[model samples]
Target chain A: MAAQTKPVLHGYFRSSCSWRVRIAFALKGIEFEQVPVNLIKDGGQQLTEQYKALNPMQQVPAVEIDGITLSQSLAVIQYIDETRPGPRLLPGDPKARAQVRMISDLIASGVQPLQNLYVLQKIGAEKLQWAQHFIDRGFQALEPILKQTSGKYCVGDEISMADICLVPQVYNAERFKVDLRQYPTIKRLNKTLLEIEAFKVSHPSQQPDTPADLRA
Target chain B: MAAQTKPVLHGYFRSSCSWRVRIAFALKGIEFEQVPVNLIKDGGQQLTEQYKALNPMQQVPAVEIDGITLSQSLAVIQYIDETRPGPRLLPGDPKARAQVRMISDLIASGVQPLQNLYVLQKIGAEKLQWAQHFIDRGFQALEPILKQTSGKYCVGDEISMADICLVPQVYNAERFKVDLRQYPTIKRLNKTLLEIEAFKVSHPSQQPDTPADLRA
Candidate 1:
């Protein structure tokens, strides 16, 4: 794995899940070749036969490196962290690593999956309402943990994988017009997170992989 | 922390989530005292003043140990694993830890959040449809990963946190009328998981925390 040898990220530009992985890679400052898989414009480029071969479940953000294709955003990021040493995303201690993993799970398993874009797309007639409903619930569930656990960052000042999960979920919240004022801790964390160059360069607007028309 | 000492678990008997923690405690052969924070019949006692003091969010499965109170199921479980060394719930390697966390997430974040009792209670006339829809989507998301990684257990031979997340989500699926026949891997995993005495004792039906009405 040479520094110049970037991994191929099979993902879409607007997907919030994809944004999470993008932020992790940027935070770690790893170079990756973007293999854009448009989720909507082409009826989901992720549904193609070739993509299915890469991920049998047909999901986005599958990464290919060293001839090994890996699925799942968190797993891919952890693999990158293990293979390459940089800014540590997890605590060196086992208990702290578990804490980081727990915080990451609160977003990954708790908040993010509920208001997922596909779920938004699947709910047709009252799509907007259902999407907003889940978004509100996810924000509500996540707020408590954010209040108690965060200190400058998600789990203290040093950035960990949990921060990576939080940034994209917060971005999704803003995208859907979910007022995050109620969650003061979240707002503060997001504010500070936005100040970091790692989150800035990986912001959805800055990605070169996104379609020009979709780039707001 | 004596093995015979009574550890208090703040949970509702009717709460499937509480059952997960309870099962974990019992499976480890750790004796714990049960404190009922009735979530439903008592106007959600979990949301009462006492519980709010324990958990700002007022969710179940909060554990009080060594004069410290911790919320979030994964955090509580991790605390248990760190403080009490019994059968190791996690692997020793970082790569393996990542995989276990990823699989646990597939169940915890992907499956559990959607069918969470509170979420279902909030759903309207289209309840059954949404429940079944989400359960189907969760299983669809998990199948590929399960097919790829599962051995005698979710990862290889030993039971990890992944098993904890899986059993509860599968139980919730059946509660929502999601047919298990569609997911052969999950069905097989559950079949094997149920055989373990720990899982059997942890079964919601067998828990003191499970309310009479909800008991199978």
Candidate 2:
């Protein structure tokens, strides 16, 4: 609760939403402690009453900062951006900011949720097909929009929340065997973002809870 | 494109995402033109190349405002809130703003997308059961958070984007037969929000494209 207290992140190593918050913190040069809530452990640790108390949604990447806990990766990212002094995660211009939000929401709300671990578990035997179908659909729409919006990043040369959202999604796409060649703009943008130090440090493969075999 | 030009909204009458935009515009008292893109007509009008050009995502509720076309309801609502002079759609306080964003994302990304027509169509014969399951899961999480955050609205006394996201999802919950008694806080907030003119005018049944039998 004190101003000098380090923030705590309750997250899973490979959860895209959790990765988003990690990238935001790294980009802002803010140090935070990690409390990994392994999503797949013991029939999902996030479903336990203890973790649910921190985030009633029982989702990973619930952050305790500035004396309060916040969930939803986009919310956590924006909060860190607003309260921290760093390179802006959202652009200064209103239109560009809107573009960044549009891209972020398109992936966060429209695409990723369809293929998430929880949803796939419910999806049963056809999980791979379901994940591939939705990822492909999302990337198909994303490609043209990125072509219009990208300069050096997802919106006119700035590393933004959109760029933060892009990499994890592309990682998911590759995991599901979605061909990147079909979405050249998204592919190029994800590649460009991955080389950034903040993204590299915050990557799923680099996380504290990343299984030893999966660590970078 | 000009400041004086009326914005054009391309949307479906029943889409909760589109309804969220309608509520925000009405709350801000912005006058705009509506172009109905019937989702079920002609095997889905939103699938047309013409509509896809406006929104690469092929979703309803794409808005042409200030010369740029934006898809994604939350992005469009935030754009209007930032640019227009009206009651704030987002609270000014940092923590409160994050709470609003959290609730909005919970419903928008977590609950609604899973039950959307596209997803439900894929769900086949078990569509009702699938919708009920997710709505119950979302409302279960939301009820407790709303209990913690609500004063007279989802975050406080003022109507925020969280309120905009809540009503439509509640409507969907009712349509899917989720019991409202289980979520006293959400039910109370939705009841209070519905009495306001902005929400009433923006209800799905009152839309310009609402079919004769369906109109309120």
lDDT of 1 by residue, B103-191 (tens): 76556666677777666676767778888987787688687777777898887888887787788888778878898887999999988
Question: Model 1 chain A — which ten-residue stretch has the worst lDDT?
Answer: A93-102
RMSD (CA, angstroms), candidate 1: 3.2
Candidate 1 on A1-216: residue-level lDDT in tens?
434567888887766677777888887888788888877767877888888777655668778865567667877777778767689887676555655766676677666776776666655667666666666765665677667667888877778888888888888877777778888888888889989988887778777776677575
Model 1 clash pairs are A109-B109, B13-B209, B13-B210
Candidate 2 deviant stretches above 4 angstroms: A1-3, B1-3
Clashes of 1: 3
Lowest summed lDDT window (length 10), candidate 2 chain B: B1-10
Per-candidate DockQ vs. reference: 0.37, 0.90
**Which candidate has the top score in lDDT?**
2
The reply for model 1, stretches above 4 Å from the true place, is A1-5, A65-69, A92-99, A125-148, A213-216, B1-7, B212-216
- Give the lDDT of residue A76 in candidate 1: 78
